[model samples]
Target: MSSTPINKPSALQADKASATTSANLPEHISLSKWEDSGFEWAGQVASRSFERLNALLTTEHLQSDLEIKANLYRRNNVLHLSFTLTGEVWLTCQRCLQPIAIDLTDDYDIALLDNESQVRLVGEEQDCLLLDEIITEPAPERLLPLKKLVEDEILLKTPMAPKHDDCEMSVEQFGEIPEEEENENPFAALASLKGKL
Candidate 1:
C-alpha cells in the first residue's frame, strides 16, 4: 500500500482564494448568456480603479471601495439589468473648496435595447441603455465590460456640486465685506441735495 501525503492550504492562501473567487466579476460579460443563466454578481471594487470617476474627485488616492451588485434577467422578452451601488467618495465642497465626503446609494433598472427603435417598446419611463452606445470593441454582439457599466453608474450618481449638509461659507473665504459709511455713499448726498433744493 502506498501512502499519499495531504497538503492542506494555509489560512492566508484559503482567504486569498476565496476573495478572488467571490469579489472578481468577469471583465467582459455576454448579455445573452448572463440573462439566460440568470446571473447575479456581487463584488467590491476600489474607487480609484475608475479613472474618469477619480478625475472628478478631490484626490486620486481614495481608501473607500464601491460595493456593486448586478443582476441580469429577461422580462417581457426584453433584457433588463438591475444594479445597486453603495460607496463613499470625496469631492471638493463647492461652497468652501474643502474636501467633503459623500455617501452614494443608488439603484438602476435599465432596459437593454438592441437599437434605438426598441426604446419605444421599453416605454418612456423605463431607463433604456442602447447596446450600440456601449460597445467599444469589435467583440461579439451584446458583450460589454462590466467595469464600464459600474463606472458609468457611479458617475451618474455623483453630484455635480457636492457640499457638506451644514457647510457655511465663512468670511475667511472671501474676506469680510466692507461696511458702507453714510458719508461714503454718493446716493445719500444726491438725496440730501434734492431735499435742500
Candidate 2:
C-alpha cells in the first residue's frame, strides 16, 4: 500500500498536482492496512468532482477547490477516522433569486466497527460507523471508498436553505402583497340588504 508523507515538501507538491487533476486517494482503500500504519493524506479536490453535490449548486463554476485532510488509525482495538474539509460552493439564495457563495468547513471523527453489534461495545458517547455501510465489495477483501465518505460529509454539512448572511429581503423577488382598497367592501351589500329588511 502506498502512503503519502504528511510533512514532506515533495509529497505536498505531488498532492497539489494530483488534487487538481484527480483525487490522490485510491477509489477503494484497505481499512486494515491504513488502520495498522496510521495512514493520512491531505490535499485539495476539484469541487466539480463531486457529481451529487453539483446537482444542488446553482452554478457550475466554483470559486475554490475543496480542501481535505484525513487520517485513519486504531485506538484500543477500534478503528477511528478523523477528517477535515473546507471549501466554497455556489448555492441559490432562498431569499433572493441569485447565486450566492457559501463557505463550508467541517472537522469530524468516527469509530469504525465491523458489525452493528459492536456499536454498543464502543460506548454511546463516540460516533460509530459500520464497515458494511462503507464497504462496496463482498467478503474477505473489504475496501472502503474515501471519496464517497468525503462527499457524504460535505452533503451533511450543507445547509437545507442556503442564504447569504447579509441578504436583503426584496418585495420584488417575493411579490408584494396587494393592499385592500378601503372603498371596496364585500359586506357593504349585506348591510344594505339588512337595512331594507
lDDT of 2 at 24: 59
Please give, for residues 1-197, the per-residue lDDT of candidate 1 as tens digits.
Answer: 21111222355235434544576555666764544444556778777778898887786335587787776666656667777888888888888788888777788888877787777667788988877777777865567677777777788888898887898875454777799776776688898899799
Residues 12-91 of candidate 2: C-alpha lDDT, one tens digit per residue: 45644554454554455566545555556677777767878888888634557878887776665677777888777888
Q: List the residue pairs that clash in candidate 2.
A: none
* lDDT of all predictions: 0.70, 0.71
Q: List the candidate 2 regions with Cα displacement exceeding 4 Å.
A: 1-25, 120-123, 173-197
Which residue window of length 10 is worst by lDDT in model 2?
Answer: 1-10
Best by TM-score: 2
In terms of lDDT, the best-performing candidate is 2
Worst 10 residues of 1 by lDDT: 1-10
RMSD of 2: 6.5
Candidate 1 lDDT (Cα, 0 to 1) = 0.70
